[model samples]
Target: MRALIAIDWGTSSLRGARLSVTGQVLESREFARGILTVPPGQFEAVFNELFGDWMAAPHALCLISGMAGSRQGWQEAPYCPCPAGFAELGQHLLWLQADRIALVPGLSCMNPDTLNTPDVMRGEEVQLFGALQLAERNTATLVLPGTHSKWVQVEHGRVTRFSTFMTGEVYALLSQHSILGKTLDLNGTFDETAFLQGVDQSQQAGSVLNKVFAVRTLGLFERLSAAVLPSYLSGLLIGEELRHQNVPPAQGPVILIGSDALTLRYTLALRHLGIACQSRGAEATWAGLHALATKLTNKP
Candidate 1:
């Protein structure tokens, strides 16, 4: 057997790759990730039907990340605590269907009593690790832009701490589902002038959060174009990330993962804040799958 395959099954898509002993995506493609589309009882059946088309042999072993381990996915994987080193991960692992199929656990951290608010994450953890693999570094910070954005910090091959933001999800909700959907789709390229404007607004001193209501109130008063609200909202979130987030420039390197457009927005945001940033790994999901496959195979 070749030893490994990496599967990235997210909420809306399923992608996998057949790897040689060396990490490489022999084949990877996107498919429906919706539970409704695949149905509960028929998961394996649908999975087979989709990938079975090009299967040479069942992967020697497949490691999956993302919603694939959610309650709605093929299995439920546990959330390991932070300060999780490779040894702990090796010991605290979960297997969905015997030794042949396994999952890399998502992580969670919290202040037990004071804030009851815990940070929980699903798939981005694996990609962060993949970025580190490419960086070949013991420490790094990675940012992923999407519906729920993630900023993760890793030290000595362990995820020490991380934070999440609902920026993308909030943008989608207010832009499409909320009354503001009528104003803007925001599919265009990142606007430098508007993004810089948001960054400038972020440093002005008051609570940046209070400005959210402006998206609605401004629309009502004709002070802001509904069509521009999405971009402005994006700017506010990115600007806050730039201005308030305590990460420092000397904290190793920053790795960004997301579609080109979203990454572009983040790039613009970082540029506006004068933060030096670098783009890592062109294909994160694929690169992540490669890492998962390699990790599983190298384990004794």
Candidate 2:
């Protein structure tokens, strides 16, 4: 079993792992540089600097997933359409610098909720497949929360459909740049009570545009303190996202995959909405890359 180098490169950061044939991470490295920051044609230079020490052998397999395969990244690995799995994705791998390094293709699907509009995801497909493997479920809904959160439905071992929500990015903009920021204190503690109030408010009868103004009004009126405004805003945004997206009632626990902080808030929001959810750490990416690597390695 040859050791494998797995890279999860994204818009703002790069993470690499050296794994045993059995999927154990033997060593890992990270770089603050993302595809957006890497100068054109300098990807290999950056990769060399980061992984040169451990490239080890001429035949060592380097598998990368994420924005590195985007049109703006090192090389554009065209997206594989939905109803795809490791086999379909493996066939589209873009080889770079000889056949030693390969970039994984992202996935795309027709947005079921939005007519004629398509939704796409990079890096997360790997994580979704990994979650599928980890849970050993034939059918499940995976919620990966981030700047652009994803709600994906997997059935019969293939990703059939998924949708993205700009929950995190929107929250960031409002909390840092909007009029709401004028009176809000982002450095305050997490107030679960205020957060839940926002979640509950999301269900009320009014447009989100109307409700968000309350963030300002409540603070100005001293009904909602500046200290708790951040949490309240967070909850309101997440709650509205969940409500608008129509997160289905759990057939089973919704698989929540992400870092602790993001997943914790999502879990809280889901429970508040009476949807069952279970948390899984980000290691699903490793498992997914391993699965893809195994498929590629065994391919004739």
Candidate 3:
């Protein structure tokens, strides 16, 4: 493959990397200009302004992943249904410039949960592939924690199915706008003891709906300090997410892909439940894109 430019353009931020032939990142840059911040029809202008020189490399190929392909993004790249791997995604790339640039289609699958709703992930599919490549494994369960967390199951290198959770968004709504927000000291550092306390409490036999009210009552009664309640609430929600997983003991450590702050909390929660896990971050995106570029180059 020639010089590769990988871009992860998500809701709130955009990241780009120029990679060596072997997939090592030679140069990288990030901007706050995500699709949400870009005016309609200006994506190209923004892209060129931010990364024009990078694209000037001879025969440079760019593969963009994430919300840049959403309906509101640069161009809608129709989703590729599961089970999909590098080849499927490569075949579905929505080309912007013949072979020079394209968007990596996201993945879609029926929810494994009750109701069987359709689930999808944009940027995360790249991270999943990257995680698999980095781990050098064909089968594993991976989790990407964020506003909408995903639990993905891979079989023989393709994403067979996955599920999403609104843990982070719920935490924000509850801690910022809900009644529980009244007493939360939202500015304090995370308190490990309080967080573990919430995690332990979530393990008890009861619906989370009932347990969440405790956040309010615990604060009202001063049983828990207001400053640490946010961490405690975080534990309860994250712990609930962990509790619902039916991860088998033989699938190996659950691969986590996300930022350090989010992954750290997940790591703490998983270990608290005696479940083994491993984590990857930004590198996963670049690696995933590089892998896709390589596959596209070697195609017969």
Candidate 4:
């Protein structure tokens, strides 16, 4: 295997890795140069500027993942349908330079819960595959928490199904735009007690729509401090996200993939629910890309 230049490019940021033939990341770099920051038709030039030196390595091969392949990005790499694995992703790679540089396609599926409505993910697919490798399990439940949290199920090395929740995004909006913002101290530290209280509240039989209003009421009634209401609100949203999951004790510990900050809350919430879990971070992306690269190299 040649040295691999793996990239995880998203809407707000870009990250790159230089990996050895054996899949260990030798060096990595990150920048604020996401697709939204690049000028029209400047992705290649931007890539060359930020990572051209890495590309100079003899026999280096590059594979880019995330929004860089979206219709609004450098090139639209049509989505690879669900039940996809490394082979499917490698087969759909949108080559920028034949046999050298290419874009890793995202995944899509019809969510049965929404009446067979469609759902898709760009960069998370890479992390999902990477988590699989890190956990050494072909089938498991995985969760990626962010502005859009993802709950995924993989079976026999393929992503069979996944569902997206607007937990983070809604939290942002409610804490900023909605009346709830008036009481929340957005900069306050994580209030575990208050957060857990909200989590406990979510477990009760009631619509979140009605429960969210309690943030303001709690503040008005002086039952909770302004400094900690944010954490409480966070618990409500995250707890609600967890409430819909069906992870029985027999399925195995859930695998979490993402930054420490985001996964921390999830870890607490999951443990509170009596479900065992583990976590992996950025390395998952590198491992995922390395897995795809190895698959490509081994192809007949």
lDDT of 2 by residue, 87-107 (tens): 899888899955678999999
Candidate 4's TM-score: 0.98
- Model 2 TM-score, all chains together: 0.96
| lDDT value, residue 201 of candidate 4 | 97
Across 187-293, the per-residue lDDT of candidate 3 in tens digits comes to 98999999999999988999999899999999999999999999999999999998899988798999999999999999999998998999999999999999999
RMSD (Å) of each candidate, 1 decimal: 2.9, 1.4, 0.9, 0.9
List runs of model 3 lying over 4 Å from the truth: none
Candidate 1's displacement at residue 138, Å, is 1.9
- Point out the higher-scoring one by TM-score: 2 or 3: 3
lDDT of 4: 0.93
Backbone clashes for every candidate come to 0, 0, 0, 0
TM-score of 3: 0.98
Candidate 2 displacement at residue 28 in angstroms: 0.7
| Per-model lDDT | 0.70, 0.89, 0.93, 0.93
Model 3, poorest ten-residue lDDT window? 107-116
What TM-score do all the candidates reach, one by one? 0.86, 0.96, 0.98, 0.98
Candidate 2 Cα outliers beyond 4 Å, as residue runs: 246-250
